[model samples]
Target chain A: MSEATSELYSWRASIIKKQLMALTGLMMCGFLLVHLAGNLLLLKGSDVFNQFAYLMVNNPIIIGLEWLLLLVFLMHTTIGFRLILENQRARTKAYAVRSTVARGSKFAFISMSVTGPLMMVFIIVHLFDLKFGSEYLVVQSDLEVRDLYRTVVEFYSSEVNVAIYIAAMCATALHVQHGFWSAFQTFGLSHARYNRLVELSSDVFALVILIGFGMIPIYFLLGYS
Target chain B: MRFTLRIWRQAQQETTGRFVDFAVEDIPAEMSLLELLDSINRGLILESADPVAFDHDCREGICGMCSLVINGRPHGPGAGTTTCQLYMRSFADGETIVVEPFRADAFPVVKDLIVDRSAFDRIIAAGGYVTVTTGQTPEANDILVAKENAEEAMDAAACIGCGACVAACKNASAMLFVAAKVSHLSLLPQGQPEKSRRVLTMVREMDQSGFGNCSNEAECEAVCPKEISIGHIARMNRQYLFAMLLSGERS
Candidate 1:
């Protein structure tokens, strides 16, 4: 395509991507909160957590929900890849001298050009380890409830795995930190006090998830398991 | 105080542009940025070189004509102020300043520090105005616009068509400019009849003019001489989407 046609195409694609990312990211955020609540059952004890996991695994309703989650994950990844590729292509021409006006959240958003794909890889690895690995309880015919907890513990016991998980959590945290406020801004949700509150909540939620997910691996590494 | 001014000079739209440097000495600190340019112009004339060409009428910031990118900022560093109002005191003595006309593929250079922003005028001509017949003046209170809406209309109307937002933008997007015109008229009851067409035509013109798409960076709001809110851009987007979906179907 010619530059003009290509430019117009990319502009439309960007608008579509913006809407898709916001919708998917918001949905995933809701899922994360619920997932966190469910996982907190581990704090109660192994039986409670395992029973919860078992119930989820055995229920046909949840099986349907799992399919929906997979669909959402696929859509999110596809849109993310398109966005990243377009951004890279847009900036392929190197600037002889960078303009001084480059500042603030604009730079942050451009840097997301790098962080977004990293987060995608992290998510895939995350799903593979927890959902499809040998430790996955749903795949084992004679799986005991306690075996689920042991599998999680054993997965984190390896130093290399622990390190990888922590890095992934950090990338996820940064992605959420920038993406949350940006989605709000894009949707025209700007009231100063409310936006500040949203920003605070985003930061707090990101920190909590990072620490929450990071702690699991550290727990095993430090012999808590 | 002495300062080096790196000013862009170009004779025509098709010609290549480059920055040329000149030094001015013993300049008063309180002189407005425009006045500083005037001083340089005077110096150029005395030295028998071509006087630096720039556009300005109302030197008092209200007229948006005096647009410049000063030290990489639209209308210098002062927030919510135009180039004509930006005083030389904002800069330190011996500071090197770079001045350039608004750079955009849509806004081609006409001369040094002056661009043909006629693209804006064309976009406005696309359908920026309300369709009222010329006759006796209507009573102000005849149309009962809610006070908030009236205020918003006035705020949007404050956009001076300065083109600073375009110059300040990374992609040279004209969303802020187009939004101002669209929102200004759209806010009032008198402007409602042609509102749908106004947004559609203006946005189409904006895109056709080779302006880039808005990424919601808010840089336009940051550099706008009128301090027009990015909220207008959102309103414009909403209106455009509605117009595209509803109005286009009827047509």
Candidate 2:
């Protein structure tokens, strides 16, 4: 192969794919933290949450950032699926009976295959449900913004909708639990002294995020409509 | 100990392979797993049946030639122990043991229990060595490597090329093996000159050989006979990223 073409072929290397996955995954994790912080305003009631949502959508800078986030999400999901498909192709014949005995959590390890596609589908449905669900997204006279707070509450108030939200949140927790520390490992941040700390902090972050978003559905489920 | 065996049987790479059942009686528990296979092959020879073909050399375990997936775990159940080091005593009497070759598209079954692992050789040939002049022997103190780096390099150098990591990986990824090769040499002063180009060529070769991407499941570390850590893989990632970005290749 020519030098230029070989350099081009290097981009298809498995390590490159893994690096892209880690980079995009960490970026999405950052977005998750910010999104969770904003969602917490749901606990402060409708006006505060609606106005926060309004600012997020209407402000030009925030809108630009939102577009950037969409691009990040697109990259993450695309690379994620590519890795999954490539991995599946690598192992053409499945073992008749297999067992994975490893140091890491098995659920977290295997859940990547499950949670990745689940989260992608959920993100799509979620975007539609919140961002463009209804034509009645006009600014309310009192709140002076779109009633996103009411949209969230209405979405979560249904038993079926709340159930789906909770299930998706669990998947998100599992995905983050594995991906968080793993992203650091991919970036060569794994030190003997800090490995355990990274794992512990990742677990804590996953749980906190899970409960933070999960509570919104519980709040509306408990006759708070 | 008497055990029923379900061993994969194939004539060649072109033919489909399947598990065939055999009963072995009056076997001693003190025999190593490979020795047990030897006895099974001995039985087949006496019966005029085709014997099982597996790979092994320097059965004391340093050669990394022994490759077997015993009861679905690569190199058997013992952590950091190769199949040659695994003994029959570890199994219960009358236990059913299923044995097969490592399953991966990159590893084609050469016979019953042997798969062609020359893919690893090709990957190594792609860029596992440093280019240097060989003439007069240089003084031992010519290049002073840090103690920590030396130790780390030694750790990475322990990889046996057994292909266990590939077998253990759910994705059949060889990142651990390739990382070991890359990190060991790159840790030293002698290997520095070719560091960037070496990593690029080796990694590209690995992908071309049809190995899968690592998902950081760490099954490779768990099953490695040398106990080679997945940290090597992380280090390789760092090296590869630094090389790619520094080389100005972004896609």
Candidate 3:
């Protein structure tokens, strides 16, 4: 990042910042998709869940991927927060009476300024509780794996943990509701006729992420297999 | 028609302002909002009071001079029209109307219901034109343009530079305004010469002018008097990204 290169991007720095936000956020969304698939294995009970967890833990490139995921997450969160600050500077004075046009998702879309930071805080809490809280080892065959299923179940058996997880999932869902389509728009994939399809899929995506992850704590707490 | 009007009055940029209510009677429905203001100003002058100061030109809505945010929406209630084109019929009799200047960090209040929109002029001067001189409207048939591209270019060219997009956006973003200016040029063959350079320069100018970034909300489109689509914003995004990537390696 030299002066000349930085100057080049400064010509359209706002668009560049937006594109960077989209790119990093898109990578995290891809990870979320994969993570949702992995988390679904919990419903299969202890052995099945532990088997998937074993594969995840034993992968050779897992450390490299974890670093990359962390980097992407940090970049996304940092840019989003920076943009929020810039937006504040952009409008130092507020209108005495301001109103927005009638749009269904407008409220949720603007709520990204609030929900995005909440998602970051929630991610830290989530990783602390589930990823690094404790590890239980169990053997089924000739090898042993961490019984993450038991850890997850025991963690969610508490009302506080379930409440926090569910609440955070709602924020995450609100973030994706706008982020999904906004990413495509930033990438220049938006069109008049097909935008409805993209917007529809964004809503569906948000709902799936909300329910798919939200059901886990409830399922574990209720002792439902 | 009789109505109660709440109008913002700022004596100067450094001075604070508040709403002053005026009651008007026997207004004709066919009278344009500007004429209504004219009558109000005349009455004010008769009473030896300061007349309401506003902006207007061409009264037909083409000059992009009229600036007013009536009842919270820029250019009043009706769609695809400017403040000068707004008629008294748009509102109901005996209703109370609130009028304010177009609010933004860049466009500050000049007086009663007038904001300095000169930032748009600077943005346009950045690169919103084709340097290639065609001298005059030399035969339109000579340079062939595809029907669809020509239509799209015309659509983007419809922006009036009213600054309503910024006023309507929650972040006060000028993306719709800049996108319209960028897209109007990028679509034509004449604009192809300076395409990359134009978008880069104009968008940079817009950001430096203290406007916020678009968050993909369609509120700008909803309030745009010319009905400029956000599709141009998408087109501007594509143009901007490709321009950056193509010329990025040089720096």
Range of the 10 consecutive residues with the lowest summed lDDT in candidate 1 chain B? B242-251
**What is the C-alpha lDDT profile of model 2 across A27-100, one tens digit per residue?**
88988999999988888887677778877877899888888888888888887878888888889998876778
Give the range of the ten consecutive residues with the poorest summed lDDT in model 3 chain B.
B242-251
lDDT of 3 by residue, B150-196 (tens): 99999989898888899888778899999998998888898988888
Two-way TM-score contest, 1 vs 3, winner: 3
lDDT of 1 by residue, A1-225 (tens): 013331212334233356567678877777777777776666665666777888888899989988887788788788777655543332332222224443224344444556678877877887777766655434334555434666777788899998988887777777777667666654546564586787777788788878887776686688865
Give lDDT tens digits, candidate 1, residues B77-193.
888898888887888889888887777767777888888899999989988988886899988788798998989999999999999888876657787898899989999988999
Per TM-score, what order, best first? 2, 3, 1
iRMSD value for model 2: 4.1
Error of 1 at A124 (Å): 3.2
Grade the docking of candidate 1: incorrect
What's the interface RMS deviation of candidate 1? 5.5
- Per-prediction TM-score to the true structure, in the order listed: 0.79, 0.95, 0.93
Please report, in order, the local distance difference test score of every candidate based on alpha carbons.
Answer: 0.73, 0.86, 0.84
Which candidate, 1 or 3, has the higher DockQ?
3
For lDDT, the strongest prediction is: 2
- State residue A72's C-alpha deviation in candidate 3, in Å: 1.0
